[model samples]
Target chain A: MTTTAHNPAVESHGHEHGHAEHHGPRGILNWLTSTDHKVIGLSYTITSVLMLVIGGALAEVIRGQLANPNGHLVTMAQYNELFTMHGSIMIYLFAGPFAFGALANIIVPIQIGAPDMAFPRLNALSYWLYLSGAITMLLGFFVTGGAANFGWVGYAPLSDAVYAPGAGADLWIGGLLLTGFSAIFTGVNICATVFYLRAPGLTLFRMPIFTWNLLVVSILILLAFPILTAGLVMLYADRHLGTHIYSVAGGGVPVLWQHIFWFWGHPEVYILALPFFGMVTEIIPVFSRKPVFGYKGMVFATLTIAALSLGVWAHHMFTTGVVLLPFFSIMSLLIAVPTGIKLFNWIGSMWRGQIWFSTAMLFAIGFVVTFLIGGLTGIYLASPPLDFFTHDTYFVVAHFHSVVMALVLGGMAGLYYWGPKITGYMLNERIGKVQFWLAFIGTQVFTIPQYIVGLNGMPRRMAVYPNDPEWQTLNTWSSVGAIMIGISTLLFVVNIVASWKKHPAGDNPWDGHTLEWFTTSPPPHHNFFRLPQIRSERPTWDHNHPEAKALAHGKEDH
Target chain B: MRIESKILLWLGIFFGLMCAVYWTWSLENAGGVMMFFAMGLCFLPGLYYFWWSRRMGYRPEDDPNATQETGAGYIDAFPGSSIFPFTLGSGAFFVVLSMVFGSWLLIPGLGLVIWAALGGIAEGRRGGDK
Candidate 1:
């Protein structure tokens, strides 16, 4: 409520000489008590990288187990735990939080012509809570009975205390609850920051594509996560307090949990993808060296995707025996319209413009191709008949990995593209292009065979398969491709570490139009000196060419 | 210097006693039925209490601020920022009542209705302050 004018005193922290002395805090105390969003973002990114390795290792375990029929690499219980942890880590901890919690924290405030987040302390709290929740979840593995093996969904009856008795399930419920709390709190902070902290002339329409997508995504999180938390509470009560929320013995429907979870979970899918949409929007314009084509259309498409995402939760439940077919199918098909509109805008943004084929742009363009195929496969899954055939098969895995993994990969691309701007150092571009090509090829080689094997009735999560000669070649191919992804990712790490000391890109290397490019690369504690008045969606355009600005607004020399 | 802590202690003890009695009576067999009946009876009065609380000199400062960069100052920039005084309070009362009575859906249903009504009022009165 304390209103203060824009003050440069609040914004100045970096000395020109100090930039060379490591801008972020160093050592243990620096990490424990740090409030800088960049430091927190780095923490999240590191954790996500570690989890990706863990998730990929689990995939190797899965591949080894499925290498031959009657393979004894791990017990069924252990296999369940492995896959559950893999899915949980990949979707929730790795991809979901990185795209939003890390990137949005580091980027949105700067892009929106603000200093740091409106609530920097609360931002720190969100990260700490998330870390606590993640630790608790990992502790579930070391506990007496081992981690929750009922998959990340923790579907009822399987998750019921009667069937899956122990502290394992309880720990899972508790950890997920804490994680959900972190997500909700982060959402609230982001939403409030975007809404209340915009610079004077910056209206909602004029927001950068990334910030716009974040605003939409954060609102989705706020609306969706609370219901998920409520459902988790109900699930916890059933496990610990002997409640009948989802217990069949107590007349509670198991499918109710699915309904509530997917209600959050489906929007969760968009929450994962929309920021990448923003990334693409931002990158296309910069690399193209033209104004983003159809900026209003892009914004509308984002909102449309968010709105449509909410109604399509039941698509995940199509094979649950009692799920309504026509309703979910219709909703699923309806989502494609908005998604198609977004694709059109992306393609339109790049058309007939001078294109820069940087690693970031390569990955962005790769996303379109991979995501397109993923979307086409999704349409097949939308139908009840096709889903019946494809449920729990490698084909579904292929579809999800194509779209969702592309999102993660695209987010990484954005990081490399913007990290220089954010940190005031250039990343080794040579190594980055290598990382991009390897990831692209690895993704195709791994996923395409899975699609074929899945079509041939190869079920997922099976530790072993009969020496069905058909699946052998494909599985081998997938394994090899996984190794490639692993290697490429390692090279990416090497590139980062090598460049950390030497490579430096002064502020605004990309000559970008967004507000983030206004300040010094790797800005201060309080972000900007003076947040410029935003009259159009592209304020940089307005500033650079007064004639164009006058012409666009229909104001002549008079 | 430490006088405030003693006062907080006394107030905590008083609330603890009231809560103990309420919980014990609600969970016990014979007393629980009576408690359930009493709770059902209290719903109307509880709603009226909330209505009265709205008319009190309640400020937006009473609610937790959504953002933290304001450096732990609990007040947000908006006026009339709370629906908590009505919904959270009413929710607690209903939850306790329903728990005692064995009605699973009562509290959540009532909470939803109250929230809807509040939303209607807010929407109807939009921009009046501005």
Candidate 2:
């Protein structure tokens, strides 16, 4: 079914077709000094996967400790360190890096039909900064007092020199600052790439949903992260440089820290979310056998969501009592409209089309359900009166899990969908289907009881709770659910591991629509030898089935 | 029309509109000012791209009638093999290390950083064959 113009069988040898620089040094040396986007992307991917393992192990320990009311598997202090490192690692290391650094690096240039990233060396530097920052953060566990335990938010006085009197706190600040810079640089590179380098017919509007979302997320990172950098610098000053920006004893407002942190932190939620949304959007269309229902609407919704995210930061500060209630509440609720628009487009894409329930498609569906649950709970928390009660409760815990589960589910879809393209092998879908069900059931099992105990007045971040039968029973069930999720994750790892030496997924395994599918399974040093004529977003789809080539040119909404 | 500018222009207006709405509704809070700042952040890049589009004119992709061949041939030079990123990363390692063990660590940290910076510039200017 391959097109005569862009045949994968012939052009698969394009690496040797005059691009002599493609045949560079082998193995480790190639990786070290190399500026290849694929190499850098794999660096980001492998590192984030390892960080996920570290964070997951910490979570299993946390679940074990909370299995019984009196279960003190680790001391209270060490427990703080566990959750703290876990939160930091997942956000900064696992989720953000995987979504932004790894996926963006590996896929963006290919989708846009570019030779490489705009600033290839700067792209390499971004990965290096991330690596150094990751090492710095992990190095904290071995230090005198273990990593920053003032919560991942690092809420002021708790993070001050008095309470967390350790070098770990300083290291945490330093590490985040480096990672922050890394994110900013990556953001710049993506923006520049989109602005400058598009293949002939790849106009801004013609670009894929994935590229649009990365562009918006990059802008968000550019604006949102520097605020964190400034706030962290001030906090560091209060700790070592003798300034009192957050110290109430020294007349510095403690609430100011909340304001600054959430300003960065709330947008950080959308930063984590929008890319995965893009991933689901990409997958839904492929499996459903249709173009996206509304391309312009998705792009506008993304822009609207990003703009609104900047103003709704104070929704997180409702419990602090100093925030503007109506302003933030209305803004936070308004954001739901744009997100709802995205949901409508996804459902419409699958509505009457030939929907296939592949492993990736199942995960995308799971993401929709989980994201809805998380978004609704977030809506409830936006109201100041309700948030006052549920601020630090297990309900919030459940809500956070739902949100992060959406990330996990969406990320799995991306991995399954793109893994063949990254490594030239097909992932076993039978194993994948089993893994998906396990994750789907396990997350709900873990999250549902958390909502129950939370609504029943159990506060979160608790090392140990009082010995009550209701709390004890629910805790045991939740731990059982957590173990199930761990097993599910382990199965995924095995599936990917087994995939290493199995059947070769030839180019266009899915008979896909994008430019990436036109190239070989794991494309050459330069991304594409030839791009299909981009009359519509689904160019490759048009080329493969010329009978429907005219039909593939979608009547996109103006 | 450079379509990149159109994309950013709309995004900038979205941010600016939100800033106006938020400011009018809640000027009493400090968040209004922050919204204004956010608007500026969007506009800076958006307007710069707009200006660039005006100056440099349409990209090959901007034309509906353009062929794929028009976009071919050396777009720009990308770095081939370079040792500077490793040097820069090592320099950053020591700089972060300085945060843990007194300020004495900046000696090696800043030194290596400076060395990498100068070396990268020289490598770029030399145009290969070091």
What does each candidate score in C-alpha RMSD? 13.8, 3.6
DockQ of 2: 0.45
- Tens-digit lDDT track for model 2 on A135-210? 9888899999888898888998899999999988888888898888889989999988877777777777777899
**Where in model 1 is the C-alpha error above 4 Å?**
A1-27, A67-70, A541-558, B1-130
lDDT per residue, candidate 2, B1-130, as tens digits? Answer: 4566666666667767877777776554455666667767877777887788799887777865566766655565566666677778778888988978878999999998999899878766664213
Instruction: List lDDT for all candidates, in order.
Output: 0.68, 0.83
- Give the DockQ-based CAPRI class for model 2: acceptable
In model 1, state the lDDT of residue B106.
73
Ten residues in a row with the worst lDDT in model 2 chain A? Answer: A1-10
* C-alpha lDDT of candidate 2 relative to the true structure: 0.83
Expressed as tens digits, the lDDT of each residue in A115-212 for candidate 1 is 45665545665676566556656666777778888888888888887877866666666666666776777777777677556654555666788998
Q: Candidate 1: which pairs clash?
A: A119-B69
What are the candidates' individual DockQ scores? 0.03, 0.45
* Clashes in predicted model 2: 0
Whole-model lDDT for model 1 versus the true structure?
Answer: 0.68
Model 2 TM-score on a 0 to 1 scale:
0.95
